[model samples]
Every structure is written in C-alpha cells, then in structure tokens.
Target: MSTTTQEAFWSGEFGKAYSDRNNWTSAQYDDFYRHEWGITKTQMNEDCLRDLPKDAKILEVGCNIGLQLRCLQEMGFTNLYGIELQHYAVEKAKEIVKNVNIIQGSGFDIPFKDSYFDVVVTNGVLIHIAPDDLPRIMSEMVRCSKKYVWGFEYFASSLVNINYRGNEGFLWKADYSKIFQENFHQLQEIYRKMYPYVSASQQGNMDYMYLLEKQ
Candidate 1:
C-alpha cells in the first residue's frame, strides 16, 4: 500500500505504542478540559460562534482522543465530529465521547462532501504536514468547510523545523496564518494570537491560534 510517511509512522506498532501512552488520568483531566475550554471561548469571540446555527456541523481534524470535540459538545455545540488517523485513538474517543462522531481517517482526503461542515478545524495538526504536501491538506480542509477554517499550531514568522522526540521531519513551526491567506484569495483573517510559551520541557515553544472566515 502506498502511504505517506505520516500514515506509515502513525498507523503501525509505533503508532499503537503512542496511542497507549496517550490516555489521560483523572488528575490531568481538569487541565486538559480547561485548555480546550479556553480555545472554545476564543473561537466564540473571534468567529461569531454564538451566532452560528444551533445545529452547525464542526469537524476537528487530528482530534486525538476527542478532547477538543468533547469541549465543543460540553459547551453546547450540537453537531460535533472528529477524524483521527490512529485507530486506537479513534476507539478511545468513541468510547469516551459517546455523543460525538469519531472516525478513523486522514487529512489528505477528508471523507465528506464539499462544504459539509460549517467549520473545519485542527489543533496542532498542520505543522506536521510536509510543506510539499501542505496545499493538498489545506485545500481538503477548506473544501469540507462551508464557511470557516481554524488552526492552532506552533507558529513562527518564517518556516522553522524542530526535532520532535528525535524525529527529524515530523514537527515544524511556521506562519500558518499567512499560508492560509496566501492559499485562498477570499479567506479573511478573523483572529490571530500567539500564546505564551508554557511547556516546562519545551521552553521556547510557542503556539498560535487562528480563525479565518471565507468570503
């Protein structure tokens, strides 16, 4: 089977091992929930989220274990869906977040009709995509969303590569928002913010959150 490097890395034994290590205990639940909650608050204020139709569909790409979708569901968004590349993660997400739909899939080809969702979003996902293949991933995301696209990823003013767990090509930081605007002529920037570097181990790491609306 022809697979991208990502699919090969995240779908085998190593992927299963990563999945096994991905669960959260009760002790860590509060922090995780709070983090996602804060993002929802920001999304609401920036994207006119409160004014969206009650049943507006939202899909989170790379939604591992459904933390973001769970937050949306808890925050009263009626239609929530997530697509994950890891089967173990998808199973866990479905078991835990029973109210939301979780599917095992990839970003290269989102298995949904064009404009099927009101918003297509991803948290820390785009940075992993190889730049040569980024346009395909970005187009697939925007194609699935009827009105908006949201992204939260490590951001830099220019493209920068970082070693992740000793892996050379997996992680990167870049001006993702600018990439968005450049790729789509009608995309209007609604919000952009660089979060403070907070992780103890990755001291210099910073994340950016962006919400863009299509005109």
Candidate 2:
C-alpha cells in the first residue's frame, strides 16, 4: 500500500485501537516487554545509556507511556525528549514522567532540529509504521542524531503478512548493516531471544538492538 494510505489507516484504526482501554492495558504493556520482549528496566537503561555521554541529549521515537523515560532518568539521563502518536499513551506518560518533553507527533516527521540529539532511541515502534515509510523515517532518525542511534525492532527476512484488529499488511525488514553503512558505522548488535509463549506463527521472530555511530 502507498505511504499515505498506510498513514491514514494507522492514524485512524491502529492508533485508536491501541489507545482504547479494552485493547490495551498498562499490565499488558509491562508483560509484553518483560515476558514477551524479555526486557527489564535495568537492561533497557544500560543498553540505552552505556555509550552515551553524561548529560547527553536524547530523543526517543514512539515512546509509549514513558516507561523508558523512567529508565533513562534512573540512569541519570536528564535531557530526554520523546515523540508518540497516541494521545492516551502520551497522557499516561506525562503522569509518570513529569519532566519529560514529550511531543505528540509522527515518527516519520520528528519535530526537532538537525543533529540535535546525541542519541536517538526507539523500541518496538518501527513495526507500526508501513514498509514504504521506513526509509524516510530512518533518514529522519539519522538527521536528528549527532552521535548514535539505537533501535530494537522486530525482524523478518522480507515483509511478513500479519492480521490484527481489522488491519492487515506486511512488516518489512531491511538489511540493517547495509542501510547503516550508507550513513553510519555499526558499533554493536545485540539479539534478544523470542519468548516461548509467543505463537508458533511468530517463530523465528527475533528482536535486534543495534547501536550505530554517525560516520
């Protein structure tokens, strides 16, 4: 599907569905990361903050409910900013992290100056975007970061078909090494194992946490 069509579909359907109480819950969010993604707040903090300089400026795309923001704060990261599309999630985030500078915006159109952040982080956000928008969004990510860009995303060799909540489409996976080489040098890649409880249909599914430094 075209980018415009995909954006419209997501803005209306997936966004609303996820923001709905019946569709999403705080417990589900915690469980998904802890059980499904195999992430802990400590691990998330270390992964994002280790290479970053003290008091570095950081931006997180599609940061839901500021869970990671709390983690960043615990790691002594002060200059943190985030962009999230869902209003409900944004509101919840504000309640948890009062000092966070969270903006309601699209990942493809981040509202920040070029090279404004020392690091840019995103987790599980890329899967929601349509395949065609990936390049543009990635460019935006590169444009905003001065030093490094870290991402944890779901991967498949090619686009994979999935159906959920009246939305059906293929999620694309790019050759990260190839793509990063075009604009940055890869520093590290940490692969996270898939959870056992995930459906067999999602077998072979893996999450990769990548760290890239601008060339």
Best by TM-score: 1
Residue pairs clashing, model 2: none
Misplaced by over 4 Å in model 2 are 1-3, 20-32, 37-41, 170-203
Clashing pairs in 1: none
Q: Give the per-residue lDDT of model 1 (tens digit) for 18-112.
A: 65675664335545523544333334333545566667899999887876676567667789889999888899888768678888899888999
Question: Candidate 2: worst 10 consecutive residues by lDDT?
Answer: 188-197
How many residue pairs clash in each candidate at the backbone level? Answer: 0, 0
Clashes (candidate 2):
0
Estimate the overall C-alpha local distance difference test score of candidate 2. Answer: 0.67
- Superposition TM-score, candidate 2 onto the true structure: 0.76
lDDT by residue (tens digit), candidate 2, 1-215: 12355555655545565545433343554565666546654565576457667689989998867877766776688898999876767787787777889988877888899999998888766666666666788888888988787776666555565565555663445444345455444333342333232445555666566667765
Structural RMSD, model 2 = 4.0
